[model samples]
Target: MRRSVELEIITEALSKMGPHTPATRLWGRAPDATADMAAEGNVWAGDVHDVALHIVTRLYGRPGTPREASPLAQAEDAKRRRDMGDEIAALTGAHDQLTSAPWYPARPGDLVHVHYEQAGDLPPFGETYIVGHVGAGLMSLQLLAHTLPETVPGLDAEATAAMAGCFAAEAADCPVYEAWFEAGPRSLTIVRDGRPVHIGGAP
Candidate 1:
């Protein structure tokens, strides 16, 4: 029989009996079992139901069955979990706040990066796009380079110009629609996204 089931049965029997249950452990290899306390560990004690339960739990219970964690250990684990949650929330808020501002006052045909403030299966690095029409405090952006970005590492201008050249012989405007337009769920923060490439009158 499984140790857990046997223990349950033994416990049920002990429950029905008096507190001073005549509990004894015949500790040995089965057939030559003997009522002894010298084999290993405190297998049994005086006539008590608690002692019987402890003996059965130690001897017949599943090996390496983890006992419930102590209160202090549990508290520490909860604190660590709470701390981790706070850290993740802080990181997300920081990212959203950073992306909430436009790098510059963008104009039509300017190269830009469109940021994604929400989580999903998206490009980890921001996508490169070209700013399009602006009307009624809302600006549109066209998908320029998705697979191969127009910008280079360390914001290298010459290398990026070469890469952009490789993408196209000349720059041209593309149409934008609501389907392609990027915005949050609640309200449109068009000015916050679509940051322009030019800085100090240079690309």
Candidate 2:
């Protein structure tokens, strides 16, 4: 399927859940997964659900399944204040925030109808992933149900163009981003909300 169609399906499905994005994540400096906590790092994914689950299980203390856990319960007031367009005031007013939030499962093995990668299917560096989020500061994330045929590293052409447009569109228009990847290619970095904050690639 085309990337544009995929994004539309995602946006509609996520809307059914709530106003927020379906998932989020932070990537770790170390690429390998381990039992030790110190080794883990930031939230990263091709989709939101992957990152969201990472945040819930790692950052927050909910080590089990994230069926309906609300990571935002702590940031309610802060989120509300931000919604009012007073982020500075919100940070100083009421502050209870976390690195990420709780969301549906990210592992491809868990999803019912969504296509994804398995342990053996992943490539050497990593499996091409996707993460979808809503609002500011990546408040919500949802994993994509599909997988890319290859991986591209460093940056994505379309996504990069979109990021450049984001800086010009910010405030004037809400930002939206989409990236594609394939194996044997570097990552692509795109600035969606404001500037290119993460590495995005196409394979």
The most accurate candidate by TM-score is 1
How close is every model to the real structure, measured as TM-score? 0.22, 0.15
Clashes of each: 0, 59
Residue-level lDDT of model 2, residues 1-203, one tens digit each, is 21222234443454345345443422344456554546325333334444343333333222332221222332354366665433333222222221121221222122111122233534233222233333353422223223332433444656533322111111111111121111100122323333333332321
lDDT string for model 1 (104-171, tens) is 34456656443333234223343455565655555556556544345545656676455331222122
For model 1 the local lDDT of residue 75 reads 34
RMSD after Cα superposition, model 2: 21.9
Deviation in Å, model 1, residue 18 alpha carbon: 79
Report the number of backbone clashes for model 1: 0
